[model samples]
Target chain A: MKKVFAREEYCLGCKLCEVYCVTSHSRSKDVVKAHKSEEITPAVIIESGENLSFALQCRHCDDAPCVRACITGAMQKDPETGIVKYDENKCVGCWTCIMTCPYGAVKRDEYNRNIISKCDLCSETGEPACAANCPNNALVYKEQEEEGE
Target chain B: MSLSLKNPEFLIERNYDRCINCQVCERQCANDSHYYDEEMDKMLSKDENCVNCQRCVTLCPANALSIRQYPLEYRKNSNWTGEMINNIYKQAESGGVLLTGMGNPTPKKIYWDHILLNASQVTNPSIDPLREPMELKTFLGRKPGKLEFDENGNPFPLPPQLELDTPIMFSAMSFGSISINACRSLARAATASGIMYNTGEGGLHQDLYQYKENTIVQVASGRFGVHQEYLEAGAAIEIKIGQGAKPGIGGHLPGEKVGDEVSRTRMIPLGTDALSPAPHHDIYSIEDLRQLIYALKEATDYTKPVSVKISAVHNVAAIATGIATAGADIISIDGYRGGTGAAPTLIRDNVGIPIELALAAVDERLRREGLRDQVSLVIGGTIRNSADIVKAIALGADTVYIASAALIAMGCHMCQKCYTGKCNWGIATQQPDLVKRLNPEIGEERLKNLIRGWSLEIKEMLGGMGINAIESLRGNRLMLRGIDLNERELAVLGIKHAGE
Candidate 1:
């Protein structure tokens, strides 16, 4: 399956992933427009330690825990795409998925206040905005090869 | 005129002159702080929802966004302040314990700031790091007090050691709490930098086995993913008794993060709670701990040094003594202010002592008892900068473990929202989208840069003391002087008050 992998050694901790992520999700999809007026909550985040920095997002594991933990069935894993999907309408904001997620990747969608937000791999573009915009290719979207070297 | 029952902690302001109404804040804020009113042809903001992660502010291309603490006022009561009143209201409504993330935000006594280093005057000539051969190489293992020679009159081999180019090692932050990319970054950095990165109880990932030589695989109470092969793969083994953040508590990895890879590494069922029991079931007493330590030694054929990691709790000095006598080659003391993926608010904030005091006490006790040569001391729990590293060594630490600083180098903003599982910075989350945000390739370089910078700083500090090697500075308390410290504090620290 094609997935985004982090090359942490090259990350500069610029957090431009967050910027592009917000802009991609904005109404106009224009960087300037998003920055000037919108309060876009970035689905992707950058974590920088004193000596290391990298962007973090959803891993979309095959046996996703968020899907299993959602009390309202608001969270689901796409069998075809291997993505964890969230349904805002079905969500009761119980935050069970949030509590169960070990990665701290599912966020509360503050706009609705009752729905959770996560990365959907930017299905429309077939590439994550953060990865697409990464200057150093620290975040890359690619398929994994079969094990055994 | 009346105060609202609750108020937003932060205020969001937009510079209209700079704003082009791009609506970036609306798109970036998961908290829904910004919205565009198409009918009004204007942008609007709701201050109540801002978590102040600064995502909108940082990503703003126009540089139009600003967030600040909301200046809402309450009657000034010293004892029952606004924050206290809010906490009471929250508890009354939710009846749940308030949880926080990251390190202790409250200002406390940071001994590093109060203690100053002494420089050479005339008797000793100070050396410059740029011109002199200053050494920061550190070895973490038992050092023989007296050299034992074989029949050939040559000194016998010393105990196994984890040799490092610098006196620093990345602390144990498991794969479950942080992403694989974060772990890989640390591993790669450690390998390249010639130090070590710990694989906190979460076991070693299959991809990381290549960096095994630089890895310190931890065997915590849970014994998660511990196997014979796992034991043989690392340079050293660390038996984790407790963590600095929650000393008596066990680790809790939410079921949502227990995916296949994590499940495999941890040897737990997918979508199940990965709880590390508070105490190692087999180790209730010091003797039990010794048995486990030896068992590990036997398993690894004693090729690797065994380290026992414990939180710096009360009587740490005595506890450390027991550990050294129990046959641990290295003793790691994590102080109260250490970082964790998630910890109970009460224990994280209240339990455990500062690493500074614990290190000083343990070093003193061990030296006095003539057991100092039997084990190496590694201290951690917010060792911030190079100065703190120097200070820790002079206070008797063989080396220091750094987690928060390493996380910062990788791009963590210290939002302390790790429990939420929605870490915007990828360092601490496992969700595929978030985890991928941290590219190990880039993360490793940043880590290398940070360590290189700190190593230089350490060398400079050593030179300023007119010392050419790091060994000469270890436990050299005379080079340190205390300011605004009591006589008892100074005496315990084994340093004289300034101007004495």
Candidate 2:
């Protein structure tokens, strides 16, 4: 399955990915409206230092620990697409996946303390919002690494 | 010890309703103008710190920011404008010379706009550039006066030349003055576009060695990175006696900008100001210049063309003659309105002459003295576009160097805060984070695209004039006519007034 990838060298560290990620996940799907009204946290996290940065999301690992760690069946790896999908309804405000996930891709929703937020690759848009909105080609949704590497 | 009696130059207005407190503006501004207020639970701006680079405005996702010139009323007088009063306040506060970045921002006469190019009339047919082939290739070097063929109809050995597919080349902007990514952008673009990019006074970086075929290494007064391998690494060598921005003045790269890379490349100690003296100590006369030129030639084993770069000043024609007679293969004259990393405001605005007038005078003087073929004229100091390039060639320049335009291509917002080392667009800053803002890959693509667009326009203009080859327009003053120009101006430009 295609996954979102990040190249640290090209990352500008502007966090537009985070901004757009919140917007795409919001009901308005408008930058200004979503940012102003909605309190959805950005599923993608930007790890940045002095001159280096990379936008990170769920790896959707083959032996996904989030899938195994969930006490409730809210977090499940899609058998077809390989995305570690999150369901808000079934979540019991469990912090189990957030703890079990070694990559720290899972996070508590800022607006609501109970539920969790993570990358779903923006399934409706057919590509993740973080990769799509990156000003620089830092984040890219690709099937696999290029043929060379 | 003293309070500044100055007003904020710009006002940053943020729309509170649109602002989502994303803090992107706060993150992007290197000046620390934007900040998140914990007390207010919102984003706030410190307007005084803003240089009006628009990095925050451009990156503000919700379009919540806009900067405007602060409308501070200081009892406006025509003679003592706000600008003049502000300059006084700044000078009094700092007690130092006013330093500026980029080119002169004054409203001086632009000769390129005043002069007009000719198009083919009813008597001649203009070719369609899209349908027909056009030649823009240019060669910069000393000519053999006339071609000499051996008995077997083979030409004899020729002087070294820097062959370019276009008459446009990236002017010398040193690495210390601009980021290495900016340098890499020009280097990559020049290589891709089949043109040349100068290494300026700063030494060539190690990564740029791969593009040596398109490089013109420079030896300035400071001789900052001059060595055996450095000399041999270029397609040509340019001796930078003077720059157009701060003519008759030396260059100073502040210790703050001399990071490890710049320090190593320039062969200078870390954190020491790189000072290039006004005069080359040994070059006191034209003869002295000849010795240095020949010395560089000898050092390069006569394999590369040596160019002497000078500022276009009063009696520039006479100086060009001296430089040509001094055995330099190419003469590059930079006009006063040129860009620089940093220069005193007084020198930048008041010093050298315009390239149009200088190019015409020098070309006419060389032709009159029968020394025209001995050197090629490469001019810079504000060749803004394709029309400027065409007009420059018509006035006798073989090639035009573009620094400011190239910087603009690489996303320079022209904030003129380059000396502060906080260029938000990343063209002029050396700070690692800011430097990463301009990815050389993207920069190279943009620069190449700019050149590509300009080349097409140049060809179209050339075809409209019924000229196929760019060289055919060389010194063709009849192809140009001055509009709204007086007698002395027309005389200096070597062109007739409109309807003459």
Candidate 3:
């Protein structure tokens, strides 16, 4: 499957990926309206320093740890997409998956503490919003089949 | 002790309803124009700090930001305008010459707008570029007066030439003035487009040495990076006498911009100012210029063409003739509205002449002296579009150089704050944070797209003129007519009035 990857050298640390990701995951699917009305929490997190930055999201490992770490059976790895999918209703808000995530791609809902926030790579949108809206092309959505995995 | 007289030039407006206090604008602004007030729980702006580069406005997710010219006006006097008063106030405060970036912003007469191109009528049908094989390829170098043959009927080798896929080139913009990314972008674009890009006085960086075939290394008065390897690495060498932005003046690259790479490339001490003196101290006369040109020719073993670049001033026609006679293979003339990283505002605004007249005059003079074929004419300073390229060819130019347009292709908003060393667009700054904003891959792609688009437009125009090759359009003044120009202006441009 194609995945989202970040070329950190070109990242401008503008956090525009977060803005676009939040807008894509929002109810209204509008930039201004989603940023203004809804509580915005982007699935993609930008790890930034004084002069360097890169977007971080779920790597979707073949042997996903978040799926195994979920206590309430809320997290499950979809066999087809190799994605660690999250079910909000089945979660007990114990934050076990957040602690187990080595990449720290998991986040808790700010308003509702019952569920966890994670990345689905915007499956319905075909391409990740962060990669699509990147002004510098630092984030790209591509297939890593050439890696010989 | 606490008195000031200058006012802010721009006013920043933000829509509070749309702004969620995301702080993106605050973080993106290199000028620190926007800040979040903890006490008021609102975003505020320091409009005075804004140079109006539009980075914040473009990056604002909510589309809530807009910049407007500050409505500060004078008491209805044309003699002492607001800018004039503000300039006086700034000089009174600093006691230093006013410096600006970019080209002249005055309402100067643009000859390109006054001139109109020709199209084929009922007599000769215009060729459709889409269906026909139009030729835009051009070679810039001296053409031998006559072909010599040996006993075997094999002709002697022609002079070295710079083959261009289009009649446009990225003009000289040094690395110290712009970021390395910008340089790399232009270099990559030039290499991809089969054109050339000049390395303005700043020595060629090590990474760009791979593109030597598409490079035109320049040796200015400073001779910053002029060495054997550097001279031989380029396809051609250009002796830069003056620039259009500030003719007859020197250049200064501040100490802070001389980083390790720039220091290594320019052969200057780290954190030391790179100063280019006004004139080549050794070049006192045309004879002196000829000696230098010959020296360069000798250094390159006469393999690379040597070009002489000068500002379009009052006596440009005579000067160009002298340069051609000095054995220069090419003569590049820059008009008054050219670009610069930093120049005194007075010189940039009031120094040089328009290139249209200068080009016409130089072509006329060279032809009169029977030296036209001995050298190729390349004009620059402000080549805005494909139409400008077509018009320049019709005005007797082999090619046109474009710096500001190329910079714009790589994302230069032209805020005129390049000397500040804090360019947010990553085109004219050394700041790593800002410089990384310009990805060379993206820059290269945008520039190629620009060249491709312009080449298409050029072919369409050439097809409309009933010309299949760009060389046929050179010095074809019959295809151009003046719109609102007087007889003297038309005569200088060597073109007739519209009705005529």
> What TM-score does each of the candidates earn?
0.78, 0.97, 0.98
Standalone chain B TM-score for every prediction: 0.95, 0.98, 0.99
Tens digits of lDDT, candidate 3, B93-185: 999999999999999889999999999999998999999999999999999989999999999999999899999989999999999999999
**Quality class of the docking in candidate 2, CAPRI style:** medium
Candidate 1 structure quality by residue, lDDT tens digits, A22-87: 778778787777755776667876677764777778878778888888888888898888888877
**Predicted structure 2: clash tally:** 0
| Alpha-carbon deviation at B141 in model 3, angstroms | 0.6
Which candidate has the top score in lDDT?
A: 3
Q: Top DockQ: which candidate number?
A: 3
Query: Could you give the DockQ of candidate 3?
Result: 0.79
| Model 2 error, position A100 (Å) | 2.3
The C-alpha lDDT values of all candidates are 0.86, 0.91, 0.92
State the DockQ, from 0 to 1, for candidate 2: 0.68
What does candidate 1's lDDT look like per residue over B1-500, in tens digits?
24446678889998777665656567545567899889987778899877677767876666778888899978888988887787777677777877767776656788888899989889999999998788989999988888999999999888899999999999999989999999999999999999999999999999999999899999998888999888888999999999998899888899999999999999999999899999989998899999999999999888899999999999899999999999999999999999999987778888998888889999999999999999999999989999999999999999999999999998887878777776655677776656765778879999999999999999988888899889999999999999988988888888999998
Please write out the lDDT profile of model 3 over residues A1-149, one tens digit for every residue.
Answer: 77888898899888888888888988999988887788867888889887989999888878888888888789988898877788889999999999989899898886776777788888767678999988889998888784432
lDDT of 2 by residue, B1-500 (tens): 46788888899999998998889899889999999989999898898898898988888889999999997878959899898899999998889999889898889999999999999989999989899999999999999978899999999889999999999999999999999999999999999999999999999999999999999999999999999999999999999988898899999999999999999999999999999999998899999999999999999899999999999999899999999999999999999998998999889999998888899999999999999999999999998899999999999999999999999988887888888888888778888888878888889999999999999999999999999999999999999999999999999998999998
Clashing residue pairs, candidate 2?
A: none
What is the TM-score (0 to 1) of candidate 3? Answer: 0.98
Query: Given candidate 2, what's the lDDT at residue B44?
Result: 88
